[model samples]
Target: MTSKVDRPPTYEDALQHPKYEPNQLHPGSVESQPPSYSPGSGMYSSSPPSYWAQAGMWSVPDLPPSGMPTAVPTLSGGLPATNPGEMEGSFSSQWETTSVRHSFIRKVYLILAAQLTVTFSVVAVFTFVDPVKMFVIKYPGIYWASLVVYFMVYCILLCCKEPRRRFPWNLVLLGVFTVALSYMSGTISSYYETKAVLLAMGITAVVCVTVTVFCFQTKVDFTSCGGFLCIASILLVIIGAVTAIVLSFHYVPWLHMVYAAIGAIIYTLFLVYNTQLLIGNRELAISPEDYIYGALSLYIDIVHIFLFVLQISGSATE
Candidate 1:
């Protein structure tokens, strides 16, 4: 006995059958066609072809004369429909997330500004005020002592538990740290003439702003090279230490200038790297919750850049 295989109906085959019901195309299909009705039946009494046509299975311009179904039914509810509050809720959530990230960035920058203000204010006092100048000059040991103290407090804050690392406490520790750092900066600034110090400050400001804007607008992401940047920074620090010791012993006239110029370049790269960290989104992003840490990292980068620029310009004048 020979058996015939049933083949699936094509679009042309569906077209040839005018009285075709959708169930006829499927095996064990349960759906049935609507009952016979008079012309008085409302639009709601539409058969499958009329229903699919109105539901936009195929465009009116492209549909055949029979208004044949063009798409397979996939939606459980048939026609696509929007839920009552779904769009509004989705927009609200997106807006809230965007606002939160912006707010976090703003808070971090404001804190950084306040910290800069404190450092510069202290620098001004030590540079201009005779009593403060005389005291720092008379007792040079305070510079190293303040350096040790600042790092001790910095280490404590870094090691603190989550509960202790929140707002006011973190801010307080940061303020103390800024004060300590400024004292060291002020003592260092006292060695240079007033005009040299001001010039260095101007140069530092220009370099910092230029690098910051570049990081913000550039398409080339520096965050990816974070490990390379970190290794470069350590190597620069070692070179700086060796250079400082050598320069202190003998006058290799051009050595200080070369070291200062290289140091400035290294810290400029550091500024870019840390700025990318602050504007967090990349894989190396610092958590938004670590606003204090972000600010602190940026503060150090800016201060180091200032120190290098001061050394370069200050040495030139001398």
Candidate 2:
């Protein structure tokens, strides 16, 4: 009989015959465990790596050693793993915020344009229509009545947030306010000659456009001037009252002209201030949620500017 020779198991045999858990006491398992770097200090372990099984032993896929760090998990190209979704979500959130602000700006301006269109239309009818102009002039009480209505609605919209933000109610209130203000504005415009009114309108348009463009581009933040602007407004009102009282006793043409010029300049500054408030990312900005208030503020600024310009132009022409 020829002597038989034993050979190492093939990869297939290693797979088909994995070591049993109970066979842990076997010398192959004991020897397969890592060795200490030094017999004394177990700081480092040495062994044929766990993936290298002895000739007779078989095993399953190797796991990272309990204490040692294994090959760092990576993407297919060996690049470090990262979360695309998290990065994508961050960008999307920023984009959504920006889009919302832009939409809010558009909504406010659209509402403002509609208001100006309605107001100027009424002014045109009152100025051009002889019968309507004569009738409105005959009944100056109509202007007073509109003033009363405008004052009441303005108070409600400004003093109460709920009325300003409420859906159909807000729109209804705003419409009423717009009509009342339109009548008052028309009455004021009627007091001036047609040429004076037209000239004032042209100048007012140019000034408003220029101020709006400046507010958008200039680094000088007008929003921060709210305190100063408010003070200036109160002082203007006081000076105006004084001027009116003085004129009541004795009309001074130069004083009146000076007052009108001051009013125009002050309200033009107000236009710049209010326009800055409309823009977002400022130290002081109107909230996106209160687009109605934004439009109301801008509309008031424009109307006041127009009236003051009309006063100055009328005085100049006279």
Best by lDDT: 2
lDDT of 1 by residue, 118-144 (tens): 888888888888889889999989998
Clashing pairs in 1: none
TM-score of each: 0.73, 0.76
Please state the error at residue 14 of candidate 2 in Å.
Answer: 25
lDDT per model vs. reference: 0.76, 0.80
Question: In candidate 2, where is summed lDDT lowest over 10 consecutive residues?
Answer: 34-43
TM-score of 2: 0.76
What's the CA RMSD for each of the models? Answer: 11.3, 8.4
**Model 1: which ten-residue window has the lowest total lDDT?**
37-46
